[model samples]
Structures are given as structure tokens and as C-alpha cells.
Target: MANFIDKLKPALAGSREGPPTSAASRGPSPFWVMVRKEFGDHIRSWRFVILLAIVVLACAGSLYASVSALKDGQSASAASGEGSSSFLFLKMFTETDGSLPGFLTFLSFLAPLIGIALGFDSVNTERNKGTLSRLLSQPLYRDDFLNAKFVAGLLLIAVVIFSLGFLVMGMGLFTIGYPPTPEEFWRVVVMLLITVVYVGLWLNLSLLFSVRFRQAATSALCGIALWIFFLVFYGMIVSLVGNATSPADTAAASVVIRHQDWMMLLSRLSPAYLFQEAASTLMLPDTRTLNPFITQDQAYLAINAPLSFGQSLLLVWPQVVAIVAETTVSFAAAYVAFMRQEIRSRS
Candidate 1:
């Protein structure tokens, strides 16, 4: 009877010759395999395909729109007098200027949508599809799963945002019939960086929301609601507060507003707004008016602020650090939340 049972055990265990297995000897550690499998799964996902398609379409659309606008300008340029062709084209784009305010407005509004799309179901879908426990049982740190999601999200943003900027520049040159000037080139570069950061910031933001909520519907709704509040309602409320607190006297109003500077300061707290301010500083001339706080004098001072790009980097290093810090804190909280969740195997 013992011999027969042993023979049956081998057949049931899939080899008829293998040794007994134990949890302690699963070969690779959990963390590495999760990361490895995650990378593979990321590339193979429908999300990846959608991301690529969105990138191509969004960039192509922007290029087409800008070029069509530029082409319409070309006919008028030949007939009417111009101080300089470059100057005229500059004026048109200046109206369309890639200043911080403009960049922030466009990117802040656009990015949350991308964030929602990428993260709304990141974990819940896995949980619903019944892969969560099996994935958790693997030899990986609990945090690794979240990390893989973040890495994939950021990489996708980098690829898409970068291509958009390059295409915009190419279309600009085609329309202008000359390469961008030194100042113009920096503006475009600044625009590109902020676009990436804006999109990437929301990657973690949306992911954090996704992980913290259990019901897929709850997560998706919160993710989108948070985006709306931050992007649209935050500004509106800030403006309302400013208005509600305005002084009775005109002179006091101006002076108090200047002294408080709360509106401008409050604006900076929004990564969206800060990104705009930074972009404005990078892209606009000394005269650009992105914020009331940054006057012509302040703008000039910033431009002439005895610093190389490296030095400026160090100066704005706080903002960069702040962004990193915020993303890290949110993601860390989400990581802990996920690790604490009950793992039920549905499949």
C-alpha cells in the first residue's frame, strides 16, 4: 500500500520522479520574477497598444493643426509688408506662445486624461480577472508590482511626449522656412520637458488613487474626480477665495494682494501651475506675463539671474525635488495600502 501511494504521488505531482517541493525553495526570489514578468506583460498589453496609438494620433493631430495654421499664414506673408519674416512668424507663434501658462494649460488639461486611461484599472482589473493572488504568491516583494506599473507608465509618457515636441518643431520649421533661433529652441525644449513631467506626475497620482480604492468603479471615479478638482476646480476655488478676501479700498487691495501674494503662491502649489511657471521662465522673453507676481522686472532678474543652465537647475532644484518628493510619498502610501489588502483567489 505504501509503495502504491508513493507511485501515485509522483504521477499526481507531474513527474513520477521529482522530489517533494517546499515554499522556501521556489528558485528565484519573488521580487525579480515579478519585475521580469511585469516587463513582459507590460509590453504585451492592450494598454501598450492604445498608448502607442494615442501618441501617434495626438502628435500627428497637433502637427497637422499647427502646420495648417502656418500654411494659411504663408500666403499672406508674401503680399503684405513685414518688418522681417522671422519676426512675423514669431509674432504668430508668440500669440500661440509656448510660455509656461500656455504649456501648463494645455498639458494639465491633457495629462489627467492619459493618467486615467493608464491607471483606472491597473490593479483592479488584475484583481477582477483573478490574477492578483497568483501574482502575489510569486517570489516578489509586494511593492515590486506597483513599481513595475509606475516604470511602464513613465516610460510610455517619455516616448509619447518626446515625439510630440520633436514633431511640433519640425512642423514649425517647415512653416517658418528656417531653423529655430537660440531662444526659440530653448522654449521648445522647455515645453517638451514640462509636457513629460506633467504627464508623468499624473501617472503616479492616478496610480495612487487606483491602488487605494478597492472597487474598480470607486477607483475610476475617484481618479477622474481628483483630476477634475485639481485641474479645474482648484483654480476656480482659489480665484473665489482671492475675490472673497479682496480689500474694500482699491489702494489697499493692490498693496495687500501684493503683500499677501497668496494667489501666485497658492498657484505654485499645484504641480500643474508650477510646471507652467517653470516653463514660462524657460520659454518666454522677459516681457511674458504668466503670473502677476512675475513682473517685467522680476522676469528680467530671473533671466539675468547669474546662473548657467546648471546653476538654474540647482535653483529650481527645489521644485524638481518637490515633484519627486510628492510622487514618492503618494506612491509609497499606495504601496502600503495594496500590501495590506486581503488576497482572494477567484480563479
Candidate 2:
């Protein structure tokens, strides 16, 4: 009986080890596995931890300032029927401290850094370490590698942005003793989504630089240069060009109007400007439009009547479309560059 049991055990072990599974047929889905690995890497890295801390501290400071300012304003206006505590959540974002900018302003300024930091070294670091070739040798395709990096970075951005936004809202509720209206809540959600798109454009831009440049330092410098060009220098350049091209003081009204339109077009070319216009309009219900060409009749009609959520969305639809287009173009450029790149490892 013991000998027969031993024979059956050998047979069972042999059956269990019939054939080795192919790479494609074994393990988890490549895309998801890659995504999980990259996402975990991002969250565990010191870069992400430092950036997250900085952003959170900035947000906390800004929120504290805003709440204090709102409290003072409310106390001063207690006698009057004005300064109702409506849209407290929006106010937390838009209200300033007289000493510091509001929460939205901080987000607009610091958000680009998060995207750029995550992406600037994404590919180059692997290449520098001679891991790119080995990584590609796995069961995963090059598409999976690139897609995982992008999707992981995007998911991280969404988590950070949404978390901060909700934190602000929670703090505002406690400080102001009021919750957001349904419309205001939806507006905040839309603004957050728009912000994710805006940061994603920067992420793709950085990723493109990473793929194009072999050295991580070169990619980082190029990414920062592009950001500075658009954020700091683009507006000045546009203003100079507009001034040079504008009609003389004696020119016809139509000619000056055309010059103004051209200036607006150039300004909108800056992603920062587009983001500000869209976010401001979304958070501030009283804001009707960012256009400079509002006629007297139109201005009068908009007076004292806050735009509804749908109306505000319609006004900013073009800006939203432009952001999406810019992001797509950036990602496409990175994809093409990475696909065509050679993957060689040191001997």
C-alpha cells in the first residue's frame, strides 16, 4: 500500500508539471500589472512625497488665510443684509488673504510642477540605468510601457487634486459653518476635472522631452524652459507684439477692435491664461465672460444676474476644447517619439 501511494504521488506531480506556459498565457494582464508597478513606484518615491508635502502645506496656508479674511468680512457686514454666506466653498478657492493669493491661485502655480516632476525622469532614468532594454524584453509591449507611465501619472494627479479640493471643502464647512450647494459642488467637480486635463498637458510635454533627450538633466531643463516660456515670457511677448501691430490712435474703431481680438487670440495661446479664465468663471457664478468685447447692452443684461451652471459651462466650452486638443497633441507627439526610439543596452 505504501509503494502504491508513492507511485500515485509521482504520477500526480508529473501531471501538474506537464508543460511550461508561454509568457503571453501566464501571469496577470500586462497593462494592469505595469500600471500597478508604476503607480506604486510613484507613490513610494521621495520625489512624490516631497511634492505632496509642499502642495499640502501651501494649500493649508492659503485656506487658513482665506477663511480668516471671510470671517472678518462677515463680521463687518453683520449689520447689513449684504455679504451672505452663500457659495462658501467657492469663496474658499477664490478669496484672497491680502497677503497671499487664494487656493486656486496656488493650485494654478504649483500644479505644473507635480506633472513635470513625475514625467521628467520617467523614461530617461530607466535608459540611463540600462533597464529600458531589459524591461521591453518582458512579455509587455512598448505601448504598454508608455501607456502605463501616462495612466499612472494621470491617476496620481487625479488623486492629489481631488483630495486637496475635498480637504479645502471640508475645512470650509467647519470654518464657515455652511456646506456647498448642489450647483456649487458640481462646479467644483468640473473645475477639478479641467485642472487634471491642464496638468496632463504638462505631463505629456515632459514625457516627450524625456523620450527625446537621453540625459535626464537635459529633459528636466527643457521641460522647465518650456514652462517658463509660456508662464513668464509668453504674455510679455504677446503684449509687445500686440502693441506693435495695433492701429494708431486715429485708426478706425473696427481696426482697433480687430487688433484687440488678435491680442486675445494670442493670450489664449498660453495654457495658463486659458486655465485661469475657465476656472475663474466656473468658481465665480457672477462672472459672465472673459471676453473684452462685451457690448454695453450685453453687460447690462448680465448685471446682477449670476450665470447658471449650464450657461457658465457653455461660456467656457471653447477653452475646455482647446485644453483637450493641446493635451492630445502633446501625448501623440510623445507616443510617436517613444515608438520610434531605439532600445539599446550597454554590453
Best by TM-score: 2
Off by over 4 Å in 1: 1-44, 47-55, 68-105, 181-190, 250-255, 258-260, 285-291, 294-319
The per-residue C-alpha lDDT of model 2 at residue 228 equals 84
Q: Model 2: residues >4 Å from true position, as ranges?
A: 1-16, 22-26
lDDT of 1 by residue, 232-294 (tens): 788888888888876666565568767458777776677766665555444434433344655
* Residue range 35-68, candidate 2, lDDT tens digits: 8989999999999999999999999999998998
| Residue pairs that clash (backbone atoms under 3 angstroms), model 1 | 30-139, 30-140, 31-139, 31-140, 100-280
- The RMSD of every model to the true structure, in order and in angstroms, is 5.8, 5.1
Error of 1 at 59 (Å): 3.4
Error of 2 at 57 (Å): 0.8
